[model samples]
Target: MTVRERLMYIAKNRYARRIPLTSRLKAVLRAYLHERGVIDNDNLFISVENKILGARSIQDRLRQYGNLTGVNNEVTVSPNAFRRTFCRLKVEAGTNIFVSQRLTGHQSLEILRRYVEIYGKDLEEAIEKGFEGL
Candidate 1:
């Protein structure tokens, strides 16, 4: 896709909303695309029949990989779980909630808050940091 087209894709507010890729992720994606000979503007991922992969297909693939890697043995591995973990990690890493909301495409802070799983240690750390200059 052209640079303008990619920017428009990122600005679009839809289920297929695109996010900015990290440099590492960009390199990995470039390598994968090169390996797959996918130089066109087609979908990044596709099914065996060359069709776009749906959400269920993606989740099924995650589950399959999780099972193969023994990650599903302790907990369920799904896209929603990844989303929650992403939000939680962003919060724990001190990313602004509004930034996380924008990144996650969350329409409301209330909904985004539900995805952040804070712990007692996090609370203690927050308290300590809050009192650091006092």
Candidate 2:
């Protein structure tokens, strides 16, 4: 569940990031890799033509899958949406912002803050907790 590989973005920027995965996610990825069998390539995901999938292709495939599963109907599902959701979930789970930033490879807290949406309940809870120590 450790990400040690470099990820290349569409802008040709490459970055090596380490991300921790849940046990369930790790198991699912392992099963997927096992089912995929051995390939003579370093890419984790390949197209039906046995070629590396570019960022655009991956985004398109995700969008298509979301549409097929009727997820797009519920919300505009995209890769960015997944990123934002991940950030929000981490914050909601009370994970440290700095840890989330590292996991997400965000360069600054300002950029990471954009991905987090704080709810009214979260603010109310924070206020109560703040007063409890006063």
Candidate 3:
């Protein structure tokens, strides 16, 4: 599916009372097994009505897809990476550190401090330019 369509599906399926997309994605993933008639389901997006896909199952399928696509990049993808990306995007959007810290569920300022350290130098340069009027 197209990127926009996929995003819309995610939005719709997010927090849905039934059939969350994670399971649906797994259903698509289990397609090969199903095609071999090893599995009975005709639809890939299984009903979250039954249960959410197990975390380990999701990870294993991701690894399988990663292998199938020849995606041998040294970096590993995990759920935490998505959180980090979201945090960085929030910082880039100029959200305050305290607010970002809360959004990220960080119990200590140190987590926010790391993001500040990562982006702080650039912020300092930007800050330096604002004193001409003073």
Most lDDT-accurate candidate: 2
lDDT scores of the candidates, listed in order: 0.79, 0.81, 0.60
What would the per-residue lDDT of candidate 3 be over residues 1-134, giving only the tens digit for each residue? 33323322222224322222365765675684555553455443343453456557666777777677766375455555556877888888999978888666666888766654566787787888887578
lDDT by residue for model 2 (1-134), tens: 23543233333246654455667766887898999988888888898778998889988998999999999999877778998998999988999999999877888999899889677998999889999957
TM-score of 3: 0.43
TM-scores, in order shown?
A: 0.74, 0.75, 0.43
Candidate 2 TM-score over all chains jointly: 0.75
Query: Which should have the higher lDDT, number 1 or number 3?
Result: 1
**What does candidate 1 score in Cα RMSD to the true structure?**
4.4
Q: How far out, in Å, is residue 76 in model 2?
A: 2.0
| Candidate 3 Cα lDDT to native | 0.60
Root-mean-square deviation per candidate: 4.4, 4.5, 9.9
Write candidate 1's Cα lDDT for 47-89 as tens digits: 6677888778888999999999999998889988988999999
Better TM-score candidate (1, 2)? 2
Worst window of 10 by summed lDDT in candidate 2: 4-13
How well does candidate 1 match the true structure in TM-score terms?
Answer: 0.74
